[model samples]
Structures are given as structure tokens and as C-alpha cells.
Target: MKVKTLEKLAKDMIDYIINLSGFEHIEDIQLNVVDNLESGDMAECNYNDSHGYIQLNIASNMINDIEQAKYVISHELGHILTREFHTYYVNFVGLDDDDMTSICSNVYEQTAEILAKRLGRLILKLYEQKDK
Candidate 1:
């Protein structure tokens, strides 16, 4: 997919998720494309309370399939919606430095994946309908 198309889909998905979310203090999230991610990593989300915005990364491979794109985007949003990474964001904790924290992040990642696959499909359907 073209960068423009991927960006449009990402923005739409983020807006859809945020509007559905009741978190009032949430700041605007921005989606960016990065070419440097390690192989097989599709995307990642970084949110900061004091810095006031969520930054999302869309890997080069993320644009190949619309469904995959939605999944990657929504998975990141899932982390935000569930407040799964709030501690990491607020305290700047390193997921790799500690064994327990690493394990916890992994658990949350699975939860996010499940939620993302479901919500991602729904968001994709809503977006498709709007375009028609």
C-alpha cells in the first residue's frame, strides 16, 4: 500500500478507538512509519503521560495487507485502552532490564493481541462502510 493510504487507515483507526474510549485525559496519538524495526516486528506504541501523546510505529511490512495493518494499529491502541503500559510510560521502566517486568509485558502483549484482532476487524468494517 502507498504511505498515504496506510496513514489514512491508521488515522481512521486511532480516531475510531479514541472516540469509543472513555479516557478523557488521553492525548492525541500520531502514527509514523519507520524503516528500521528488527525483522518481523510490525509495529510498536509509545505513550507518555507528561509528554502528552502516543506515538505509533507502522513497519514497512505493515502496509502489505489492510487487515494486517488494522491488526497492528489496533494492537497498539489496545495497550493504551487497557492501560496495560501505563506504568511503563509513567516510570520509564525498561521491559528488558528485569525478568518479572519482561514476563508481565509478554502477558499484556497476548491480551492486547486478542483484543486487537477483534477490535481491528470491527474498525476496518466501520471504515470501509464510511468510504462507501
Candidate 2:
């Protein structure tokens, strides 16, 4: 995906994450745009006891398609919302043109993706509603 499109997706997804987390005071989530990332995926997140941010790499050639892109965002959102390790986030995001099936490392990751998808759907619906 183009940097501009990826940037918009990242922002929208992060806003959804913040709203879903319901941490009223801590609503400032961030998204980073990188030309290249170690993982040939669309997004990644690093979270810990203190602070964290989600990084979306626009250079990932695999995200050229839209469905892959949606899964990528949902997977990354899983990392932030589920607090999964930054370890497997790369696979979670998948490649832009790669398979849509999830690459979950563990049960928690699977769980997170499930929840992220559900929440992501709701958020996107709301976004669409407002667009009308």
C-alpha cells in the first residue's frame, strides 16, 4: 500500500484500539511509517509494562492488496490490544500479497486476532456510517 493509505489505516486502527481499551487518560497512541522493516509485513507493535507504539512499514511489498492489508492492520492491532510480544508481530501482520490466514504463534495471539477482527469490524462500520 502507499504510505499515505497505510498512514490513514494506522491512524484509524490506533484510534480504534485506544477507544476499545477504554483507558480514558491514555488515549495518545502512535503510529510510525517506515520505508523498510525487518519483517516484510505491514505492521508491528512493541508493548511493555510502561509504554509502546505501533509501527507500520510501507515498504512491505506484500501489502499491495487490500484484504491482506486489512488482516495486517487487525493483526497489529491484536498486538497492541492483546499485549502480545513484539516477537511474532511480524508474522501476524503477514505480507501484503500473502495468505489471509493468520500466522499466530500461540493461543493468545489467536485470541487477540479474533478479538481484533471483531472490534475492527465494528470500528470500520462506524467509520462507514459517519462517511454517509
Q: Which one wins on TM-score?
A: 1
What candidate 2 gets wrong by more than 4 Å, as runs, is: 12-28, 52-60, 65-71, 78-105
lDDT of 1 by residue, 17-94 (tens): 677666554455667876546655788766656665667777765457787777667667665565545655336644
TM-scores of all predicted structures: 0.64, 0.55
Candidates' RMSD to native? 3.9, 7.7
Expressed as tens digits, the lDDT of each residue in 1-132 for candidate 2 is 677777776677667556766744334345666666777655665443334444434444557766666666765555555444443454454333244444444554556667767756765555445437
TM-score of predicted structure 1: 0.64
Q: After superposition, how far is residue 68 of candidate 1 from its true place, in Å?
A: 2.0
| lDDT, residue 32, candidate 1 | 84
- Best lDDT among the predictions, by candidate number: 1
Q: In candidate 2, how many Å is residue 42 off?
A: 2.0
Q: Report the poorest 10 consecutive residues by lDDT, candidate 2.
A: 93-102
